[model samples]
Every structure is written in C-alpha cells, then in structure tokens.
Target chain A: MTTGKGAATRLRIVEAAAAEIRERGANATTLDDVGRRSGTGKGQMFHYFPQGREELLLAVAVHEADRVFEGQQPYLDELTSRAAWEAWRDLIVEQYRDQGLYCPLGVLISDVGRYSPASQAVAAQLVRRWQECVRAGIEATQAAGEADPELDADRTAAAVIGAIQGGVTVLLSTGSTEHLEAGLNLCLDRLLL
Target chain B: MTTGKGAATRLRIVEAAAAEIRERGANATTLDDVGRRSGTGKGQMFHYFPQGREELLLAVAVHEADRVFEGQQPYLDELTSRAAWEAWRDLIVEQYRDQGLYCPLGVLISDVGRYSPASQAVAAQLVRRWQECVRAGIEATQAAGEADPELDADRTAAAVIGAIQGGVTVLLSTGSTEHLEAGLNLCLDRLLL
Candidate 1:
C-alpha cells in the first residue's frame, strides 16, 4: 500500500517528467528540467529515483503504458456482442484522434526503452497484456455466437491489436484516422464473415 | 540529376547520420558527431546539408522510407497471384525479424518529423506510396477471381498496411514476429473469404 506524502511527491515528479518528455521527447529531457518543472530539488528527485534519469524514465514508461488501457477503459473491457465490438472500435478511433500524433509510451520507448532490456520488458509486457484483453474480447464474441468459432482467438486478437497499432502509427504521421477506422472495420468484419 | 562527387558525399553524410540516430536516437545525434563518424569536416558537412541536423534527419527519414519498399523488392510489386502475396508476407516477416527492434524511419519521424510539416510530409508520402502498392495487389487478386469481389480494395489495402505497421511496432518493442505473422495471415484470409 502506498503512503501519502512520499507517494504523492513521486507521482508529481513522474507526471512532470512525462509531460516534459511528451513535448520535448525523452532524449531531450533532463533531470534538471524535470526538477525545475516539478519544483523538486535534485536531492529529492534522486531520493525518489536513485538511479537517476533512467529510473525515472522507466517509471514514466510504465505509467504511460498503463494509460494505453486506461484511455480505452470500460469499453476496452466490455465485449459480449458485435454491438459492443463496434462501440469499442469507435472509442479507439476517437481516443487516438483526440490524442493526436504524439505517443507518450512510444516516445519513451524509442528514447530509452530500446537501449535498456528492462525498459524493453516494460513495453513488451504492455503489448502482451493489451493483446490478452483483445483476445478475451474475441473469445467473448465467439461464446456469444456472434463471431466465428473457427477463428483463432489469439491470432485474431493479435491482428486486431496490430490493426489498431498500424492505424495509430499512420495517424501519427498523416494526422488522419482513416486507416485506424479501416483496420478496425476490416478486422471486425472478418469475425462475422 | 546528381553529379558523382556531390551525390556520393551527400550519401555518406546521410548514411552516417542515419547510423548515429539508429544507435543514439535522433534527438541525441548531432551534426558534429555525424561529421566525425563520416570522417568529413564541418565545412564539407554543411556543403551537403546546410540546414543542419534537422535537414540531415529529413534526408535520413526519406532514405529509410525508400528502404522499406526497396527491401520488399519485386515481390511487393509482383502481387499478381496468391503465391506472390504469400511470398511477400514471408519476406516481410523475415526482413523485420532480421532487422530487429530498431526502426530508423520511426526514430527519425518521432524525433524530428512530428513537429515539422516537411518531415511529416516525408513520412506521409511513404505511407501513401506503400499503401498504394498494397491496394494494387488487392486489386490484382480480385481481378484474378481469387479474392472476394465485394472486398473494398482501398480499405482492405489500408487495413493490411495498418496491420503490418502494428505488427512492426510490437516487434520493435517485444522483439517477436508473432503478431506480424498473425496480421498477415488474418488479412490474407479475409481476401480469399
């Protein structure tokens, strides 16, 4: 269980670093800058993150990773029928559209995660968990007889996850959500056909 | 048309910058470092990329973008049959697997392209051209009566592209190609269905 004062300060530092990384990118952000923005001294920052910038970044990566599911919540968890699936699809498109091209976790990973095996594991775990949720939804649809039972839930789930990712990647570049919509539509349609 | 000497020198600069960015991430790479790595003086470096680091990165983004299609080779273009599509799919999985987690284009775009319209344009154009090739393949499949005539060629192609992007993104994080293979399989199956 997390305590009050110490936990709050750590949260503040992380939120500030995440914002700095978002605007300036992880590679460009500095501990001093984070201290300036968070109004925390280096001593206190170090107290919270002893390993320094890398440790703080790893925290941000996990925090941002949590948000990937949090942003699509309730809907991401609800999947009993085709209607539920479509609603979730719409929510995903709108979510990424609202977030625009900047992917916080993606920025963190590219900046720091790619180089560190531990950081990479944080990201890898996110992908695995996210795919599992999608896989569960597919299974739910199949159980409801709304989706084809013959479909491989794990593979379909992976493809669906990939489709959304692809769409998000394109959206980041082109500032358009069409591919996201197209991928979701095509994948969802595949279930029924 | 590019002259022999100038073009070679420019190519060297771009190659050096690209390697640095791949290893260090774009934000961490400097023009001076590129000059050092390429064994060129600052004067020569500026002669080729006077706009400095951003310009050099833009060139690298374009270079990496070209490689995306080039690596696929005649297979990407030869999508006249299911055999061709399958071959391209296998080639893609193998290529990305061999290339591993580091994506130079993704790095360049995230670091510099996200803020600059010109850099974003380079990425947008690459995705557009890449998707166009996929659309052509889908159209060819339909023409050959191998795929469902009711399939929306453009949408399907875009979705497939998104799927590949998603798979690649996961691969970059998790160092696994399962999602990529699943996406390709699911999308290709949809065409025949």
Candidate 2:
C-alpha cells in the first residue's frame, strides 16, 4: 500500500519472483534468481522482505490471488442474467483447462506451506473475496427473479465456490473439464428458475 | 496383487508407511523409518519397493485411497434413500472435519507429485470409483421414483464428487465445513424428490 519508487521496486521484485516461480516452479526459484530477474540486489530484497523467501512467496500468492479474480473479470461482476452466469462459468473452466495441472496460486500456496498461519490468512482472504463476489451475483439474480428468491445467497454462493474448487481439483488430476462443467451446471441449475 | 508371505510383508511395510505418514508427514518420513516401524530390514524394503520412496509413496497413495473409500462405509454403498444419502453426506463431512486440515490421501498425493502420471493414475482411479458409487445411488433412486428420473446419473455423480472435493479443499484451507455442508446440501436438494 506504499507509494513512490520504493513501492515500485517492491512490486518489481514480486513480479519477477512470480515469473521465475511460474517458469521453474516455486521450489526451484531462489532469491538470487528473483534478484537477477528483477534487477534488484540482496540489500534491496532485505529492505523490502526482511523475512526472505517465505515473505516473497506470500507476496506472490497475493499477486496470484489477484490474477485469479482479475481473470474472472467482467463476468464475475455481472451475474444478473443466465447468460452472464454461464459466461462466468465458462471463463473459469477455460482458464483452468488452459492452465491444466499447474495452478499458480496453488503452487505458491503449496510452496509457502498451505497450513502455515500466514498462508492460511492469505488463502482465507482470497476465498472470502471470491465468495463475496459470487454472493453478490446471486443476490443480483435473486432480486431480478432470475434465481430462487428463497435461496440464501451467501450459503449458495459458498456452495458454488466449493463446486468450482472441487471440479478444478478433479480437473487438475484427471485433465478433464467434464466435472468442472457438470458441477457448475448443477449449481446454476439449482439456483436458476 | 501378489499373495503369500511376500505380499504380507509388502502390505505390512505399506501400512507402517501409512501410519508414519499419518503421524508425521510424507516429507518427514523415510524408508529407514518405515522399515523400522514395520519390523523389516532394508532387504525387505528394497524387495518391496525397488524404485524407492516414489514407489512407496505411490503405494501409500493407493492405501490412503482405499481408506477414503472404506471410511464412507455402508453409506457410500446405499445412497438410494434420502435418509441414506444424508447419512452418507454427514459421514463425509464428519471424517473431514475430524481430520481437519490434514487429508491423508491429499498429503500423500501432494508429496508424490500431484501431476505425475503415477499419482494421476491413483487419483483418477479413486475419483472414478467414488463417482461410480454415487452414480449407482442416483440410478437406484431414479428407478424407485425417489429422485429426479431424467438426471444424468454419471454426470450428476461426478458433480457430487466435485462438490465434496471442493468443500474438502476449502475445509483444508479454512478449517470450516460450512462450504462442504452447504455444497452437499445443494446437490441433495437438486436430486432428492
């Protein structure tokens, strides 16, 4: 949340670390590699991330989490109509399918130790944000009478998130979009009148 | 698939490894530790798993997979009635909640390299087997007019699996079964008459 040259430099390092991790994986990427890629030095890295690699990975997790949301884009924001909902679902399916077995945020979290307090906080925040978006969409559709008015938007949206996460997990292992599509379709089917 | 003393010894080794992993973690376990826990020597360990830790981990993956299925018990097999279906759902949520953030098969798969062909085969097999059970239940209920007759059982079952998986993933990160419970309820609501 800082500003100016220092903030820019910090961002550059994060971006570089993300790129390196994406290319060679988080396990293989090192501080030196990030420094070389970002054109930063040990001094600057320490100044920015005093705790070193773990801190940097968490930073990249935030970046990746942002990308996941950003990738959802306009569709995620506008789920008032059936068409928008389907489009959002399709976008999610396509993005994961394209990525196949490698999920950026997943790898970063895995490297950061998924159960660690820091990683858990970031993951929980990301999940909450994602759930809130879907909840908003559900509320919009419900108000318009496009979805079941009696439905609990927050709980239903949480279910929708679970549906996608489950489908994505299956897709990650089996390399198929069938579950992803079917799961999302089922959630929509339940919601849409 | 072998039988006799050799197979017994091999299973003993696998069980010991699984126990060790459940107690500690995959990364912290070693062949020597497994061997010691199993009351077998290096000779027996190598004889059972010539390819070493990867092979052993894959074997444990299979064991863990079996445990996942077995944990579901009579509920997984008899999901024809609404009562039975709810029971099955509760059992899943309870087991995962009890385990909390630690999913044995999940940890094993992660350690064995989730994307590797060997791990994929094991995971794919587990998913297929689980989906088949759900599919069978859907088919059974449909025949009796207890559930939606027109729903595609296979696809719906796959979606159900995705729902559980997604909920489980969220639970692993957030340590709450709310998403898992909500997701399963949605699926049941859609299916049950």
Top of the candidates by DockQ: 1
User: Per-residue alpha-carbon lDDT of model 2 for B40-109, expressed as tens digits?
Assistant: 9998799889989989988887887788888888898888899999999988998888854555447534
DockQ of each: 0.74, 0.67
Candidate 1 local lDDT, A1-193, one digit each (tens) = 5579999999999999999988877777999999999999999999999999888988997887777778888878877788888889988888788865556447545766665777667777877788899899889889888999999999999998889877887777677788899988988988963
lDDT of each: 0.83, 0.85
**Residue B42 in model 2: shift from native, Å?**
3.5
Candidate 2 CAPRI assessment class = medium
Q: Work out the iRMS of candidate 1.
A: 1.4
What tens-digit string does per-residue lDDT give for candidate 2 at A81-171?
8999999988999888886455544653457776678777777787889999999999999988899998999999999999998888787
- Predicted chain B of candidate 1, TM-score versus the true chain B: 0.91
Candidate 2, backbone clash total: 1
Poorest lDDT segment (10 consecutive residues) of candidate 1 chain A: A100-109
Q: Per-residue lDDT of B110-172 in model 1, one digit per residue for the tens?
A: 777566777667777877888899999888888998888898899999888888988888777
User: For this target, which candidate reaches the highest lDDT against the unseen true structure?
Assistant: 2
